[model samples]
Target: MRIERLWIPEKPSVGKDIVQALIRTKRAKVLNAKSAATDGYFSLDTGDVVCPLFGHMLTMLPPAAYLTKEQNAGNYFEFLPLIPQPFKFEPKPDVDAKGKAHPPKRFNLIGELSKRAGQIVNACDIDREGQLIFDEMFLYWGLDPAGNRFLRAKITSKAETDLDRSVTALEKNGAEHWVRQRMAANARQVMDWLLGMNGSMAYQQLTGIKTMSVGRVQSPVLAMVVLRDLAIQTFKPQTYFVPVVTLADGTALRWEKRKDAAGTAGFDAAGRLIDKSLASGMVGAIKAGARGTVAVASTKVERESPPLPFSMGRLQATASKQHGLSVEQVTKAAQNLYEKHKAITYVGTDCEYLPSAMHADAGAVVAQLASVFPGKCAKADPGRKSRAFNDEKVDEHFAIIPTGLVPALSDAEYAERAVYETVVVRYLAQFYPAYEYEKTSLVVMYGPDEFRASARRDLVLGWRELEKPESTETEEAPANGPSRPLPKLEVGQQLAATGVSLETGQTKPPSRYDEASLMEDMISAYKFAKTERDRELLQETQGIGTSRTRGPILQNLLKRGFLLSTKKGKRHEITSTPFGKETIGRLPPWLTDVATTAKWELMLSAIALGEAEMQSVIESQIQYVKTVIERARMQVSPRQSAANEKGAGAAKKAA
Candidate 1:
């Protein structure tokens, strides 16, 4: 039987060493090596009577030439030239059937090999996209689909040991789930194409906007940003009075802030603070000599589970909040660590927890990471298992862990090493014990006014040791610092008013969104969705976008002027631009709300799992699109309406 290998030049440059090792293990000899161009098709003959074919390069057509007139006359709907044009894939004559036919132009090796080979083995990277590439080649060859075989091979590092293991696995058996995953991946691509090509073109024609890009993901993401901006714009600030009283111990305490039965902040119909006079009167009475008594004193042993390991989004949020790194910067650094340094698995994942099986390897990964981050890694305990190691919480991939490739040299490298070290340390922390603490709550009442003080004593540092050094930098005295030791007291114990005063403060408006806070809000928005069914749906679907794509989605919104960032030192506050506000105002109300996308994602997930029908989803989406189009047409165009133009200008000024 003959065998063939198809390759792309770009792949070899990045992956040749691993490919060579695979071929060597197969005991295949190189019969010939050929290329169309230096950077084009670089194929190797496996000399086992196999034909070789070029990958992606073979299918690429030369750039089509268009005259100025033709370019101007081209339909506005024809936005993406890369998309298959009408009648482009129609069959063409090639010679006769008995080896008289001309060689296939695209991935010709597939056809050549199929003629002699009894079976075909697909050896591609064990990823969804990789599987798609192999499948495309298989179909292109017109070979018997049933005759094709699938092999899963992974190159963990450049080390021969890792390569050998991969080859051994390939020779034994391949993973079937990967094939199903590939089918899902292909479906996603097809769905995106259909939605983007049709919806985007239709929207663009109606809006008469050049280069209006939209997609299943991108459109919803854009709408989210626009909606957030509108929320900020439409927000009306109101004054709320809080009673602040100085206790006997000179400790100032603020009121516990009342909430409605539904747990909403107590406010009037117009969202103004309710019972303003009652709060002010309480503060005055407390200041006017009222002996304070210990109303309640309760201490509880609270064990805080160690934080889950670092997913890309979690890591990015942490880095943004703690290290002041931008989401883009953190993601780029992580990609380098994963792809170039080979120090970590896939950079983006939703799972912040690891399975018990991964715990055994945590020590080795921590040891490797310790070389770069001695301070943080030194505090990590390897043997213990914390809540972060819950296997039940892990999905798709485990928490980001090092691939055991020790990085060396350079200042930039050290910076990336620090980031990777953070990820590794967090990963290791999952196996460490939970941080145990004693939380004490003391409430002192002076007349009708109640003042509260809380203190926490760390009984066991556990995983918290990794954070101690950083926390130390921000530590301060009593009220601002670590909690003070409280004197023994029983309920109703009389306390002398050592100090009494009133502290007046103005109510602050809601803060603008930051990257980390935005991520939290996005997650919270889905979690707190109304209706049990909607909540359950969101719980199952998680959120509108995966952790892998959320950062990029946010970045795209910012790039598209839907979100604007205001920098204040290391902090970035996200706000909406006038264009963003206009977009939100013009968009259908349901489309602009995140809940809609959340629901759609839930349905899509259901469809993927075969719990929901694809036809139903398609029908719903079609109706949604129709409604959006109708609403958009009825609304005064944002660009054309003088009122909207003025409103946008005003919003910009306000921003």
Candidate 2:
């Protein structure tokens, strides 16, 4: 008999859970008693089959796949550019020691099952990439997506409850929403391939280099580090002075000249006091025992809400910053938490907001988390929903949060423990009340200048009681020193200066980019946009690359020898290598322009939203690839010139 239903998930692990969930719910009975959970698909007595597809079983064909034998043998420069009218794809092949190619067994299995199943359900991830993964397989197997037999099961989490909900709420596979998203994802994959293949080949052919790698996002990311390194290398410092007075009560106050027509300015435009004589005079005037009056005093109460739960990028950045973990380490740990333990939601999501509906599940999730982190989850109030519970901001997946499944882990797994606790504590903070504090601002009138001071006092230890801020973070103190708590005083209260001094300092260059800072910058690349339109577009799109690709982009650069990562204490400082800088210098401006790539991202987003046509975007990228190839052909290789010079010198020496 034809199978009643066939479910295809993104991987074997997800398929195993789906089978278990169906069995536990009594929705289906297992048919194969001897098959291990990890090895084979689950056949059910109800004629339903559960199978899984390895991530991206198929990929775009290489240039050789399109070019004729003669054209392939010709110089890469002569062919100029290879733009396949309609790109073709095939299953990624594996070669054995005997050099025979074999298609992945999983890929063949899916093809075989699609013939027998009456309906094929795409139970892959809920994102664009996931759509593309399933769609590609469907196309390769000659299965029609628009047919009524195909469906989409949007699973957000692997938890049994979520899986059942998703299965029961399946939608048509060829709906406009799914089509548009798949189209957009396909555009990104093809464009990246076009640029990487043609652009890199052009450079290699012209420069006589054996290997060169470039991409739409990778090149621009390399430029960010190279340009930052250049700025630091070329920066010039200017010396300045900062004057401050210490009151008898040990409060430090910074000196500021009054902004009046009759008063002379004592500081530079950058807020540095460059007038050495003025600084010295102020120190002499406000000597020990000199008196001053409080010209102004005020205190205001402020409330700081708890931080939102971790988005994947935010979690990676925080883990890198706090625990000195690499992006790969944190990402791997997070994947294990989601896939192996089923303890967290999707880990590739960039959104930090949760569905309002999920707010009701907070109590159950917290109860489960309490089993592992009893003390940390003690005071959480699941009833209170913070701003993070806004439904409008949620997309394919919600922020990373506990799935109410207790993770089976030991203390020895430091990386996994660190990642899980970081996510759990962040989730718990949402249930706590806002932190409240009273900030006091004071201004004292000295002989010819004004001194300012501020201090903060805790009024309500709410969320802060759960987790204290990282000690590495601190406020910038005044030139004299840290400010002390202020006593209650009237505006006319008098104070004596117990000491005064001026400190000499110089301007410092911007700090180098580390993994954490670079990741943050990648997410906020809109700030570097050159045009208002591009900035607005980048804002809507949220960055050049998706959350899943940014970390790999950085790692790929390091692997390709384009960037260097050096250990500075616990942090790895990133710097561009000489070859990296040379690559950027030789590339056209548009290639390294972050704004341009952001604009591309905006285009892709439009395609995904059904606002733009995919063909138009792909055509534009084809033109861009052609232009890059032509430009590369026009340039002479420095290596070629050096080789010529060496040959001439050798000839002269022989004569």
Candidate 3:
């Protein structure tokens, strides 16, 4: 069953490894020098050709070079957007002012291969981004599938078994619907280009700044920082006192009040009383072992739902919160699992649910894990219909999970293994029994005051056997560790306090966002939208950026001085600088609004889903670009500039 040619990833190391696996799976033979060939590489026995491509050999043209002379003269772009019919693209090599390309030789090589191959296999990774990468090469060569036969070999992992399975399951696509993905990717790239190319030039010229970089996604992020820091600056600290009483067992209770007068900052979100005098007087009346009555006690057993599998955002948050790994670090770890170890599915997806159709494959994968995690494995019900495998929630690819190719962890890097294990535990947890716990509560009455104490005991470890929770905040921890199980309790029983104290504290400013929380905010950014309809638009659009690009955007913001990070102990605190704030202050709502970009992004997504035509989305953006140009042209008045100059002149005379 040997094919005439086999195409795979372009990296020599990866290509060589994949070729070896294909040889085993199909007994394919190599005909070339086995040396990487530019145009003539072939499979010897069957006359098949194997080729790999680095992604997107051709890209949208850059600003100065992209526009024609008349357009560059600021005539066309100033009034109208440059809408290339079919949207032109060129090789993304270093370009001179005249648009000359100095591309890597491989770009031309792929173009040549596109012309020769009769049966061109789209053996790219199984994601829209991957489809765009390989499809763009053929598109740039003007080689339509109408003339050449096309096949798609899509798989989420480089693992041998998954790769072999994909080889057999290849789909024939003479219609080139796979290239529809290229439409979505290109629309996004062009959308960014339109915003950046026009917005940056307009801003730099208007503000008299030598250089300014603005973006559809980047500008909104800048505003997030600016608004947060402004709130921090203007926030007034409120003073409050919390009543604390120590019990006979050295356990302390913080007085909890559900409600108070509306004007009182009563019991902050963490439930601390706002009345200082009342708290102080209550504390004064109490001694170390003050007698009180336990008015009521209750206990119940409940089962907690298993966690959904890891999406990039959840994984980033988990790693950051549990292990102090930065979002960048966690991303690299996930990449390692996909690329080097080949232990997991694709890592760049935002979807956290599996396709229901993959139940058999998931079951097979879990069966392989029995030896590795025997205790938890015994509890797994891989074939069960659960929340993790819901087709309605799936898009492009399923959640990141083990691909059944277990790696030797003894030789793996610590960070890589940590991320891999995190994914594995999360994946397995979905199939295991639900975690059951007994929660008990007791309330003590002191005159009119009441204090509640609660304790929880694991009745059944269940999925918790593999997925243990990490405590980050005090509120997240068991009521003061409840270090001991609650002693047998009875209603109306007398209880005593050993000591009492009044602790006065000031409300702290909202802390700067770290990567994990930032990722959460970016995903849930619809919460920041100005209107209900805009919020729904953002929610449907998956917020401001894709999983693959958001982290890099934040890193770029830090590099460009739009945001600053300071290490406080193990965790970093991030905030915006003065320049970042000023930039946001001067920008118009269209540029800085998250909902604005989200509205446009939703249209791009609709284009991808084929719900809306690409032309309409492009036309809408064109109108937005016109507004940007107008804003850039309308600068502050000359009289205001001259008045400032005159004031400076007067100040100098006085000096």
State each model's C-alpha RMSD to the native. 8.8, 5.3, 6.5
lDDT string for model 2 (1-655, tens) is 4778889999888888778877766567888757845545778887779988878889888888887665554457667688887888888876789999887777777788888999998988877888999998877777677579999988778787887777778899899999888999999999999999998877766665647666899989999999999999999887877677877677778766544513236666655567788778767877745688998888889898998888788888888877788888888999898988888888878788999999889999999889888987888999999999998887667899889887788877788888888888899999989999878878888865678888877788888987786543255343433245765668998988778888788989989998888887777789888878767767866677877888899899999889998878868789999999888887777778887887888899889888999999999999999999888766856775466456545655555
Task: In model 1, state the lDDT of residue 274.
Answer: 48
Q: Write one digit per residue (lDDT tens) for candidate 3, span 288-313.
A: 34567887688889787778898877
lDDT of 1 by residue, 496-608 (tens): 55544444444444566787667655554465466777776676554666665678778888888877877766666787777666654544455546676667666655654
Each candidate's number of clashing pairs is: 4, 0, 12
Preferred candidate (TM-score higher): 2 or 3: 2
Ranking by lDDT: 2, 3, 1
Worst 10 residues of 1 by lDDT: 58-67
What C-alpha lDDT values do all the predictions have?
A: 0.56, 0.82, 0.71
Ranked by TM-score from best down, the candidates are: 2, 3, 1
Residue 267 in candidate 1 has what lDDT?
49
TM-score of each: 0.74, 0.86, 0.79
Looking at model 1, residue 544 earns an lDDT score of 61
**Span of 10 residues, lowest total lDDT, candidate 3:** 71-80
Q: Which residue pairs clash in candidate 2? A: none
